[model samples]
Target: MLHQEKISVRQFTILVFMYTLGTSVIYLPSLVASYGKENGWISVLGSSLIGFGVVFILNKIAQLDEKKHLFELLEFIFGKWIGRIISVLILMFVIYLLATNLRQIGDFITTQVMVQTPIYVIMIIFILVSLFAVKLGLEVIGRTSEIFFPYALFSLILLIVLVAPQADFSNIQPLFRENIAGAFLAVFPASEVPYFQLFVFLAIFPSVNKPDKAKKGFYIGVALGSFILFIITFMALMVLGPDFTARNQYPTYILGKKISIAEFIERIEILVAIAWFFSIFFKLTINFYALSLGVSYLLKLKSVQTLTTPIAFFVVILGIILFPNIIYFMDFSQFYWPFFAITFGLFIPLLMLLIGMIKKRKQGNGSQTPS
Candidate 1:
């Protein structure tokens, strides 16, 4: 059966905020710095505006029929066959997205923390935790986000403040080092992972108990997410320099390592790691929930939570097989994934909005016609 669960506006806001931070906090600095160099901050500022537009488009699509979600609207607007085909494509993309994220956490833990532990072992543990959340449904997920959000926010803020003294403003000077075009180029890679990938929220929008407040919350969440991204990017460049930031896979983690206040408080990269874990955990939970829920809706299943186990098994396999190593993953993300993301993130939702508007106009004309 379709779920009747509802999350408060506050819960929804936190979900969006945490979701926007997602995997971007740790990896985006390197990704953007590699392209924009000292101008990575510029790219972040530019892309966040695009992110706002994207949120507007996604919300418009979701609002087309307040009661029907993205999946049902696909069928309603496109007819059964085309809609189902599109649904299958989106669902497949979600699966891959989930696997990519799972693989990221897996690689991070194995390489950085667990050392000798095999990657798959880490993947299994993380996926199982997310799968447990998926089984519990979005209400639990939203509530959990609320509980952890305060700590995540506080810890992240502490990290930034502690590292602030290390920042060398000179490192960010000579702005637009790559000229305007290169900085603009950086925005593309910077935009894809965090902003475009947020199409997942379209599926969850209808679950918010307060639609009006949730709309405001969506804008707030995106703005806050983009701001945090900018601060982290700017800080990374100033403290570590663009080369160091770009070269290091997890520059934010290194910023944590740089924290030495009187040498009394040191090696607190754990704070960054812990805060990241909360964001990624929620990210994985939301992605997995979307995957399982999308599958249930596509198959016309009665219950949304039924497919968590079997689907997660495939994700674990793909999480391992899809990414051979960090090099391949980074290259794919920079070179190909941005375009891959917009296909769903921008074009699909834009298509939905246009088609939905057209349909509404036609219906209005039909209603006015004499019987």
Candidate 2:
């Protein structure tokens, strides 16, 4: 039997919330504004329902096998070779996600703050920091997220509070304009990425102390995270209006730039940037951790620690390949990439769930006693 670490439900919940909210909070508003116009918040709220529904389905899968990771469950249902193939595909998908996110962060920092620095340098630094966090293991990662969660939330709220004076609610008037279809389309990427990515949590199920509470915690974490995105999206539209937001690469950052609580307290975008960095840091850490854990399970490695460095290197390479330049990356994200995400994140998992259910019924509902 593989030895498993234990983590509290609260810790797990915070980890999921932080992981879900982290990168999405930075890009979600701008992405949604592209379609929803002034009614982006409606799309955010609407998409969150889809996000939560994905979480609920994941939770149901987890409940069916108290201690088994999704990969193992897949093997049980689909037989060894096919299950291993699925596991490898899932791992590749996660690696792709990690790379894409790293590229986005690199692009953001390079274009916005560090135009002089080579993008590779920034990517290396971020990956190294995340790699170090993953080496400390999931318990440490969970605790770190718990500590930083408040600051992330505070920075977001502070942005809203400071920007309140400049906010023109009129910008969001005539809600639900003719772009209803387009608005929902915008919500798909933002909602699906964070929400469906919770499938990675299936890798960490054995580490959760009270396995039964996994469902409850997963739901709560995703809901809270989605709500945060909704609020931030609404604030961005209200503060900057959809037209300006869609034009800006980082609408949330622009919202921060607009804050001025008296002349002495201006240029607070740096503070917001710092807060956002931590959020992204936690997010990268979670992704790296998931990658490490998944690899450890697949290869039968005794410890996830051994795989972190090599995997971080792998991620850096992926980041480089993900985009020739920021413009190309953004264009891909806007047009082609979302359908791909839906295939791996939603369609694959749903198919596996059905297969697992049928396999269980064929086995006469016999529960395999844990060894």
Candidate 3:
């Protein structure tokens, strides 16, 4: 297969942050609040720590196999049969994540903004756009993120500023009253998913222009993205308070709705929606690229482009099946999926890193000459 072109370290970081932030920014506060209540922000902080650790594990693996993607590294570490099996599992998990994210975006748009539009229409449009982006390959997606990420960040800052008038500092009061366990539990879904999802970026790490900078870029992106999410969560809580933020499905959207510049410039929710759509667009593109790359590697295809359409179609179908309704998606994500994601994204990569290191050491020790 023709290799994808390399992307700059800046572009790589943008791709990681934009993909990680995405649609989660809209609904995450509510999900976190569900588990955390007044302690939701704590969950956000806790999740950031978990995410940092996951990035460290992934970076170690990337450093060890600077010239290869995760699939090749797995093959080298475990041999073909077992490696391919593990790759298949990872591929399936990625596909599921892509579908879930796409469906959530589609559902969000339909439910909140375009009640009349069919959800399938939104899903198909995004899938097709993502397919086109994937066909263009990783460079294009990375560059696209570099462009959109700034606007996304700007929109976030704008929302926070606009909502400042409504924020009540007392909303998040009684801090640490929930104890350590409650704080950790709240962080489970909020920070974990955003930070851990970067694992899939392993597919593109080999294509980074400065491979050594991958770790720095990855962590910077995560820290910056988490800080943004944290601020958003804080603003949402401060503005809406726990009771309201918890009940609202999209606290960020509501924050936008509450923004009023002299009362004449109200109803700026459209701006917020546009920013969110762009964020989710980059996100879906990256996920689609990863899925295409994984399939191409598994089948040993001459080009990753060939799998784009097939996978896009499958994603649309999967989006429809995997989320019959928003509630089901929310329940699965909050209650069950975070643990599964932790296992696949964090624990498994750490295990591979340890095993790869030990195997390399043993081989090194055994290969010494008679000297």
Instruction: Return the TM-score for candidate 3, rounded to 2 decimals.
Output: 0.96
- Model 3 lDDT at residue 195: 71
After superposition, the stretches of candidate 1 with alpha carbons farther than 4 Å from their true spots are 177-179
Q: Estimate each model's TM-score.
A: 0.98, 0.94, 0.96
Give Cα-based local distance difference scores for all models: 0.87, 0.81, 0.82
Q: Which segments of model 3 are wrong by more than 4 Å?
A: 1-4, 178-180
Q: Residues 1-371, candidate 1, lDDT per residue (tens digit)?
A: 47588999888888888888999999989977887788878888988989999999978877787777678889988889999999889988888899999999888888788899998888888889998988888899989998999999998899999999988989988865555677788888788887888888877878888877788899998898888888998999999998999899999899889999998989989999999999999888888887777889987899888888998888999999997888899789889998999899889989988998999889989999966
Instruction: Write one digit per residue (lDDT tens) for candidate 3, span 36-58.
Output: 77778888887888888888889
Model 1 weakest lDDT span, ten residues long = 175-184
Window of ten residues with lowest summed lDDT in model 2: 362-371
Estimate candidate 2's RMSD in Å. 2.5
Tens digits of per-residue lDDT for model 2, 1-371: 33266778998988888878777888888888887788778878877888887877777777667778777777876789998898888888889889988888898899899999998899999999998888877788778777887887788777777887887889898876667887877667766668767788887877898877867888888888888788888888888889998888888888888877767788779767877788789778877777777788789988878878988998898899878877898888777777877877788778877887787676664665432
Note the residue pairs that clash in candidate 1: 1-302, 1-303
Write down the TM-score for model 1: 0.98
